[model samples]
Target: MPSVDEIRGRIEAALPGARVTVEDLTGGGDHFRCEIVSDRFRGLSRVERHKLVYAIFGDEIGGPIHALSLKTLAPEEAK
Candidate 1:
């Protein structure tokens, strides 16, 4: 199981300057909710934006990370 900070690190690495937040949704590292805001999401569809984040975890998706819910946004879309 990955720690929340570890998950956040991976996302930060993958998106460089992205603003990312990862939470252990169920008090278990396997379940997470991630919010990411980045310039890279510009011009991409919602699914495409999610795929960018998912690509970073690759095989880990069904392994250490059992459930990952995402809120991906471009900087302008962020609150």
Candidate 2:
């Protein structure tokens, strides 16, 4: 079970300059919802963008982290 800051840190570290917001939905650290904005997501499909973020977690997605809901966006798509 990862902390909110830990999840945010991992995403930020993986996508330098990205704006990441992670919330622990269950309060147990296993379910989370994250929104990430980054230039790296530009030109990528929605699935591709999600895959990029998901890759950062690897096996942790189904292990300690039970569910991770993501909202990935390119800089231009962010508001």
Candidate 3:
């Protein structure tokens, strides 16, 4: 199981200047919900923004990380 810190680190590295908040939805290590706001999301559609966030997870997305409920937005949307 990846630590929350580790996951957050990976996301941060993948998307610079992203503001992320991760929550464990279950007692198990797999389920998580993340709120992500990044400048990279600017001018992107919702699907594109979510895809960007999910890409950071790579294979772990469906394997180790069973679920990731995401709320992705641009910096402007966040404010």
Q: What lDDT score belongs to each candidate, Candidate 1 first?
A: 0.94, 0.93, 0.85
- The sequence of per-residue lDDT tens digits that candidate 1 reaches over residues 1-79 is 9999999999999899999988899988899999999999999999999888899999999998999999999999998
Model 2 stretches with alpha carbons more than 4 Å out: none
Higher lDDT: candidate 1 or 3?
1
Superposed Cα deviation of residue 61, candidate 1 (Å):
0.6
Best by lDDT: 1
lDDT of 1 at 7: 96
Decreasing TM-score order of the candidates: 2, 1, 3
Candidate 2 per-residue lDDT, tens place, 6-44, comes to: 999999999999999999998999999999999999999
lDDT by residue (tens digit), candidate 3, 1-79: 7767777888899998889888888868798888888888888999988888788888988899999899988887886
Least well predicted 10-residue stretch by lDDT in candidate 2: 70-79
